[model samples]
Structures are given as C-alpha cells and as structure tokens.
Target: MRSLHPLVVTPETAEVVELPAGGAFTLLADANHTGGALGANRLRVGPGRDGAKPHYHGLSTELFYVVDGAMEFLLGDRVETVAAGGLVVVPPRLPHAFGAVSGTGADLLAVLTPGVERFGYFRRLARVQHGLEPFDGLRSEQDRYDVHFVDAERWSSLRGGR
Candidate 1:
C-alpha cells in the first residue's frame, strides 16, 4: 500500500480546481498517497450569487457530499434544497448546478472518477494565464458559451435544440 503524509499536501503545491459556474476546489490526497485510479477533493463554493448558466458534462459524472451550510441544487428541472448532511449524484451531462442559498458558504467532499480531468476543464476557464478566452460570461460579458437552458426535470435528456 502507498502511504504519504497528509502534511505533504499543501495549497500552493496541490492542483487548483476552478469552474466557470462552480466554485473553487482543492485536492485532498496526501503527498504520498497512492494506489487509486481516481482523485478526491475538498471543494469550497461561495454563494454563487450569480447562478451558472446551467450546463452539463457529457463524459464525466460527479458526486457531492455537503459538509456545511445549505445549498440550492438545480438537478434537471427539479430544485433540491440540500443541507450540510446532503449527498448528490450527478450523471454525465445531466444538467446540474448548485450554490449556497442561505447562511455561510458550503464545504463539500467531491469525488471524480478516472481522474480530475473534468476539474481541469474548469481550471482552464478560470486561469488568468490562459488569456481568459475560453470563458463565456454568466451574468456579465455577453460573449459566453451559447447554451439553451432547459427545465430541471428534463436535465437528464436535455441536450437537444442547441
């Protein structure tokens, strides 16, 4: 078994996780931890005062375990109000978005299978070094990824009419 001290993992060295609509995220593996095919992370998201335009992933599925505060989840057309002890599963491109709707921000333990490549997608969008060309404005800057919003109920099968 591979073993690494948790102290080995530091914010400056760990990979940075960012999403256009989602919040910031950080890796949780120890510097020496190993033997797993997937990566784990402790994600911290703010109010998300401005909701993400509502998009879905086609290749990767994500899971969220709420650690603190309350969140307003948009899973398809149905909105789920989740609290600190909530758990949410989102299938590939199932049209999901969430943010803290009340009180303090949210802390969650997020797991991504295969790897953190999906996190990379959002990282590329938020990085200032990338020239900020890939991002489409959510509530500002009219130029953004063009997407047709659909009701939450139809999120699972809602990729049509693009």
Candidate 2:
C-alpha cells in the first residue's frame, strides 16, 4: 500500500548511521517511507574517507548532489570531481564510486529511485567495516540490495592510489 499523505523528516528526527569508514549518514527516507518510490540520505565524509566502492545497482538510479566541500567520483570509466552544488546522475548498471578528496571533506545528498530497503545493507557494511562480520557476508547480500560490487582498478590507477 502507498501513503496518501506527505512524509517529512527534520534534522532532529533523521536517523543517523555512522560508518566505520569515517563518515555518517543521515537517513531521511527509505522504501517504507516512500512506498518504494525512492529513498534519500545525506552523507558526510571526513578527509581521505572512502564513501563507497565501485558498484552498480541492478534496478535503481543513483543521484548525488554535493552539498558542501568536494567529492571525487569514478563514474563508469571516467574520473570526475564534483564540488559543492554539483550533481551527478548515474543510471542503473553503470559502475560508480565516490570519496572525499585527500585533504578535504565532503557532504552530499544521495537519492535512489525505485527505492529498495537498503538501510539494512548499510548496517551490514558498518558491521563489516568494524570487523564484526566478514566481507563475504556482504558479497552474498548484493542481490538483495541490488548493489553489485565491481573491481575498480582503473579508478584506483587514475586517482594514484586514492
């Protein structure tokens, strides 16, 4: 069933998930909140922190809007730098990744369309990062989250080991 009324999330009411990789995510909405239409979250990463690895969604489009600082992204085979107020739209099956620059931090808004329940996925990632769970566990969950991890040697080479 879909919601007939609007849903609003304030900063104080947002759910915050701290990543073991040196950042935090403020979850604004998820599949349940949007009736599977979309999900939104704010990501804040410290300098030199990896936001995510190269991966592709099987069924959703990922849209990123940089709110502050700068973020370096691996969009398909290209490396691009998106600063504050910049936007990047990635279609399904297009491999991509992002992180804060070496000496600067970043703040961005990420939105996924055709929302899938991904809060659990993010939680699992935190567990993996904290050594509470093996990365193999996350590998098995890719299909469930629609996120398929991919090798990013090209991106690493371009970033000079970023």
Candidate 3:
C-alpha cells in the first residue's frame, strides 16, 4: 500500500497558463500531487470563449463545476445550458465540448480522475494558439493526453453557428 501524504497548493504556488483565446487555466492539483488519484484546474474564460472543442477522454472521467456565469455544453448529441452552481459529469469516452455564453464569461472548476499529467498538453496548446508551434503537432499528442478531438457540426448547428 502507498503511504498517505497531504498536498496543499496555494494561489502563489499554483501555476497559471494563459491561452491565446482570452482564457486561462490555473493548475490546482495534479496526479503527481495527489498520488495519481486525480488532477484539478480552475478555468476562466472571457465572454463567448470556447473552453474546449468536442473531444473525448479514453481513460479518464471529466467533471465540470460552474463557479460563476453560464456555460454552454455540447454533451454527446445534445446541447445543454449549464448555469452557475451547476455541475456536469462526463464519463470516459463521452464526447463533450463547452464554451462561455456569448454575453457572459464563466469560471469553472474541472477535475479528471485517475489523472494524466496534462500541464504539458495545456502549455503546448497555448504555444500553438500563439503561433509558436504548428497545430498539427497536437494531433500526435492526442493519445498521450487521452483527449481525442472530434467533429461537432451538429453541435454548431444546435448553437446556430454562434
């Protein structure tokens, strides 16, 4: 059995990465910090910002807790609106995407179970968005991050191309 240890991450100790799309992710706790149990992050997005494109995790369940404002989610084949104080739990292999409402920004707490070290992935994403790297590079890392992107034209249609 593994020995128990306490992990504490204060705001000053946490690492924050700013994405090119006017959004940010603050790493709260990761697999290494939590004994491979889970990884957590705080996501903040500007109005109309896309938090994530349609994707599915092959080995981890993702959970989102809305802290403030509204979030529009495309879960599976349906589009749902999740408001502040709401929660959405996505099981592994379920297609999902999310964005802040057109007129309102959003703050969310996201958690992934049986965590995969993803800080590097997020950092690479930022680099791509900022033109420091090619987007194609991310394709090769899909399996490493456990995030597989998918087409979501139906979801876009549901949002009326918002």
On lDDT, the leading prediction is 2
Candidate 1, residues 30-145, lDDT tens digits: the string is 21244333456776766533223366655446678889877667777677878899999878657776666644577777665433333443454456323565343332322222
TM-scores for every candidate against the unseen true structure:
0.58, 0.92, 0.92
Model 2 alpha-carbon miss at residue 131, Å: 2.8
Per-residue lDDT over 102-144 for candidate 2, one digit per residue giving the tens place of the 0 to 100 score? 8888999999998989988877777776788997888888998
Model 3 vs. true fold: TM = 0.92
Per-model CA lDDT versus the true structure: 0.55, 0.88, 0.87
17-100: candidate 3 lDDT, tens digit per residue: 997556888989877777778889999988887788789999999999999999999999888899999999999999999989
Ordered by lDDT, highest first, the candidates read: 2, 3, 1
Lowest summed lDDT across 10 adjacent residues in model 3 is found at 153-162
Q: TM-score: which candidate is best?
A: 2
